[model samples]
Target: MAVKSLTPYPFAPKDTVDKFPAPLLYIGWEDHKLFCSPVCVPMPPTTTFGDLVRGTLPGIYSAHPDFARIDWAQTEWFLSGQPFTPDMDKTLAEHGIGHKSAIRFRTPGLTGLNGSCF
Candidate 1:
């Protein structure tokens, strides 16, 4: 897993640009078999969970081909091995998610492409 933290940086004023490095998240996602390498994504704390997932998909797809075929609406995300609420409205800072956090993604009831539910 990538080295990351669970604490979000202090809130910044909107008029000022943050100079610190963006938070790095280690993502683990699987469709059929477990993914081969850990996926690290850097995002600002102001980003909402919904926005993060939508924005990150393109880059993730380039790294993990299986990610391309899944229905994102049915996807789930986890943090610290616990289920992260699929509430797309909350920002990372609003939930106090800081630097170096680890996130995991899974498609409900599907394994690779073998699940008949597809």
Candidate 2:
């Protein structure tokens, strides 16, 4: 479905990078319905991808039973729907991840809670 506005909807987007103190990054765990949707978080562009995976992600996904079981070596990653291999030590800006970029990852042997896709 497409929306047909009767009048011009001219307004600045509230979520634009300039409005935030830091860039916003979206992340999701594939096959995990418990989250239902990706989570958006503000992070400095200087933050390393490793910190994102090892530090930030844990804080958000630790509630899931499979989170602790994931093997980082076997995980697959995607950025904006394209396969991505991140350099652990590189900053987000160095990897071209700007504000509003989305990153998704899948654990090879893990598929939701009890394999229920939840």
Number of the top-ranking candidate, with TM-score as the measure: 2
lDDT of 1 at 57: 57
Cand. 2 Cα-lDDT: 0.92
Instruction: Give every collision pair in model 2.
Output: none
lDDT tens readout by residue for model 1, 1-118:
3345588656544422244468766777655444565577667888897787778756665454456666777887778678766568899877667666777778776665455224
* Superposition TM-score, candidate 2 onto the true structure: 0.89
How would you encode candidate 2's per-residue C-alpha lDDT over 1-118 as one tens digit per residue?
2357899977666677999989999999999999999999998999999999888999999999999999998899999889989999999999999998999999987899889863
What stretches of model 2 exceed 4 Å from their correct place? Answer: 1-10
By summed lDDT, which 10 consecutive residues of candidate 1 come out lowest?
A: 11-20
RMSD of each: 8.3, 2.7
lDDT over C-alpha atoms for residue 116 of model 1: 28
Backbone clash pairs for candidate 1 read 4-100, 5-99, 5-100, 7-98, 8-98, 31-112, 32-112
